[model samples]
Target: MTAVDPRRLPSAFWYLWTAVLINQLGGFVILFLSIYLTQRRGYSVAFAGLVVGIAYGGGGIVGTVLGGAAADRWGRRAVLLTAHLATAVSTVLLGIATGPLAITVAAFGVGAASNVLRPVAAAVIVDVTTPEQRPRAFALQFWAINLGFAVAAIIGSSVPDRHFVTLFVLDAAATLGAGLIIFARVQETRPARVDPAPGRGGGAVRGGGAVRQVLADRTFLVLVALAVLFGLVFMQHNTTMPVSIRQNGLPPATYGWLIALNAALIVGGQLLVPRLARHRDPAHLLAVAVLSMGGGFAVLAVTQQVWGYLLSVLIWTVGEMLHAAIMPTLVGALSPADRRGLYQGVFAQAFPIAALVAPAGGGWVMDHFGAATLWWCCLVLGIAGAAGHLVIGPARRRRLDMLEPSSTTIGVKARGT
Candidate 1:
């Protein structure tokens, strides 16, 4: 594999990357929300799960679609700044709400505001970097996210339950800081109008046209479906895994450190796996990665000890590291330059889609059948998603070739790994 220097990427990417790291560092509330609800607020596990699903996932679905459209209609910088400010305000709202209704509404606000950043930020990355550089650019971005997450996990978990408000305030402050950075450093990168033909990846469409076009792309839809399945299996770590840890008699801090370990591994090795396997067929590599995730969660079904959970984290983290950089790059490759935000937005919805179903579904399953059953179901979902990816891989590659011929020709001396 060829080596690519991180410094070679444009300065805007670094600014965006730094802002992402800052946002994530203080973005610890979600990780501990379930725990906070169940242990601190005295909500039942099932109810907490419902609230998370409806508030976070439900709002995320709306925010994602709107944000994608807004990114295309407005500018990326504007959308990002607006969303960041909204996220900060909502985070504080969630912290102060007293009753269940207020809390749920506030959480929904946080979900919608925070999630709006996904498609726009992803669009910014696509806008600023060349195709050959995208993989490494995204890898670095993912690394920053997990690095912040690892630290947030430790800090959020270590604070006493009573001081959870401090976490919320800090999260809001960090979000504001990230927004200010974007306001200062990042510029508008939404592609200018090219041609009028939507079929040929041309200029931006007005009103519902972009949404209609993205929905019309059947191939991208299949990829989105695969992402949904992948997310379902992976999202269990937040929704169901914590409950499993507690049921096994492990403290919340144990879960925290375990999450930190997952991040540590990713931060340390995310760049390495992509470098080593850069030449492999991406579909085959992704299938193997998804299967590893399945196997890891499958192991979780039977393990009752911290060591067993640690092993589970190690296995799944490998899969996470491998797929992190490649998926978004594929989304960017598939999109027309003009509609990058919408395409990325539609793709981004897969996780929130999973979030919507997984928490509620996993909770119900665990409440009735047991945690083992839920983990086993994750294994099944992983296997199914892997098979689908294998079948669709060729079509996706052909589409990429048709859409981006220059993307395959590595002319840039500063090509990403």
Candidate 2:
């Protein structure tokens, strides 16, 4: 098979990619949410952290699962349109909400509505692209996501404290705009639902069977576990990193620049890293990425200097560049064509689960044990995730072999061994 250039991805893909870029640019609320809760809303650090976890991670878990099913059942375009519109409303409410309870509810709604798009967008890409083109396709999407994030971070961090409302309003407008684009340009790509096999009658039975199939796949389960471990370490940038910078006497804007640095590195590295790693063993590449991520966090354990943190961000961002494109490609490879949305949804849940658990735990650790301890823990988790990836390599290969005995030959002949 000839290599597909990223530039030649389908026109439909570019439309969806543009929507992702626009949505992320407007979705600046997440960039400063923890700070917003604690600094602006006058909540305690731990409580603020809990709300962040609940809003993004908790809501994301529900959204991924339900959205995946909905995408499969109803259609990708419908889910995208509804999720984005609902999210826009929820975000606007979050911005204007004065009471703590109102803010918390809106935060959860925003998270749920915003995250439902992940699997649906992924499924759409998979729907439109061939297997060989998937890596570059996912890479392009990741690039768009980070490009928007980099811009959002810069703006989010630099905005005056009094005008935080502007951030939410812009984010809502962007989300609604993205929904409009999907409605206008993006066609529904969900494959027609398969009629259930001879004896299965109700929707419940088919849904149950899908769940069992996903749950029973040990190889996929292991991948999800490794992802969760990596996610725990990765999520600290949002939950604890801002507080750590403040504790070290740097202003909040410093945290924004640090995150912007991460986004910048991803934008710079994403295109090149995937092509370089394409020929290498994915499992080994994943191991290296996890270790690199750990090393970045470990750097923070010893130093509070801006350069030190920047260096750490550089390390992990490279790891991120490597991992982002590979994982989704693997999920797409592992899934049956018809069940791609369900499988992607299951895989997507790992990060949100990590997002949910990491902040509350990281916040508690920072509160009691100090930021150094939290960083050390991140290092340990990264190493453990690396080990998990190594063990998963053989298992994954065996599973692929069982699923498609010709995969090795096809992969080698087309790309590399």
Candidate 3:
């Protein structure tokens, strides 16, 4: 359409679709890594979890912030390319690692490097999409991820149950594939010509300074605190939840089904968020999401039946859809172009950091208090996140609006996707 119409919608959609395919395919290793460690490698559930949680969660925390900063300080394409290269190497290593230490190191590297792509890629979307079309663009990406997850789950289940290293090989190839597609086909979506402000240096990606910026923004800091808290809870799906499900008498396929359902809900919910977001700010939306997560987990505390747990998975998945879809959109909308990647990177660290603690803590809790107790932790963290979101309020919301990417009508410039 015209430059005046911020929702240059179609351009963003196609690109988003491509990103989703790459991301979903590259991501299967993360979902299936634990199965490899415990079922194939012969580690206890706790130890296998310790490695997975530490490797993925720890690496993700470090990478997100770094990726964002690199995107801002360098250029989006440069950082994204570097991230892909690193991801490819690390994922390949996972397939070949022979010992626990080597596997842990390899998994961590993969986790960190692979995660770097997300914040930077998101920043690109923020750089290109208009405020009005932002929701649709993000939904397109989210849908791709879930769709990919659906396909990955099918493959993961159909393959021999304990074929762990195969997942890594596939993950490695996916990263390379995504990079090739971008290098070969995905256009340089960021503006070719930039007008530099007097002191702002060259207009490059600028997010490494997120700690300073978040310090200045009272609301953003509060929101981060809440996210970190919720991560402590939600991370269970990867860490403790797997342990619990196995103990509680469900197969790995059960988790496959639950996660598939989770992805499906994410796709459905993200598509709806754009319409719903027009009527409500991200903070308000986040509040509802957090509350739903907390309430859902609390429901899990009392149930021991597989069917009962399935209902809990359903409840939590709904909340996940609302939160998962909107979070990046919020970050993209909050940071200045110079700092977009940095803020998102730093924001991404929360879950990874939580991954480090959640599994070990949950394992200890399960060892001592039993499986249901982990849900209590989730319950507390989710509620706190909701409250923290409530504190982020309307003024912070305005800053997010300003952050919506400026639109371009020039045929040379790529659209939001």
On lDDT, the leading prediction is: 1
By lDDT, the candidates rank as: 1, 2, 3
lDDT per residue as tens, model 1, 280-382? 6677777877887887888888887888899999999988887775688677766787787888888889888988898999988988998888889988987
Best by TM-score: 1
Q: Comparing 1 and 2 by lDDT, which wins?
A: 1
Put down candidate 3 lDDT per residue, 1-417, tens digits, no spaces: 213465556554365468558757557677777777788778787777778777777888889887877776667777777788898888888878879889889878987997887777777776666655556666777778887887787677667855666777787787777777666655555544555433223454333344565557655556666777777777777766766778777877877777777776676666775565554556667878887777676776898677776788778776777776676656655555566667777777777777888778877887888777767777777777887776656556544434323421111111222
Clashes of each: 0, 0, 12
The lDDT values for all models are 0.84, 0.82, 0.69
All candidates' TM-scores? Answer: 0.94, 0.93, 0.87
**Over 4 Å off, model 1:** 1-7, 195-201, 408-417
Q: Is candidate 2 or candidate 3 better by lDDT?
A: 2
Cα lDDT of model 2 by residue, 1-417, tens digit: 122563467877889999999998876898898888777878888878877897667888988988887888788999999999999999999889878788778888887888899999999998877666777878889999998988999999889988888999999999988888899999988766443322222233247788888898777888888998888999998889888999899988998888888888888888876678756778888888888888898899999999889988998887788789678877876776567778889999998998899999999998899889999998898889888888878767655554443122212111333
**Clash pairs detected, candidate 2:** none
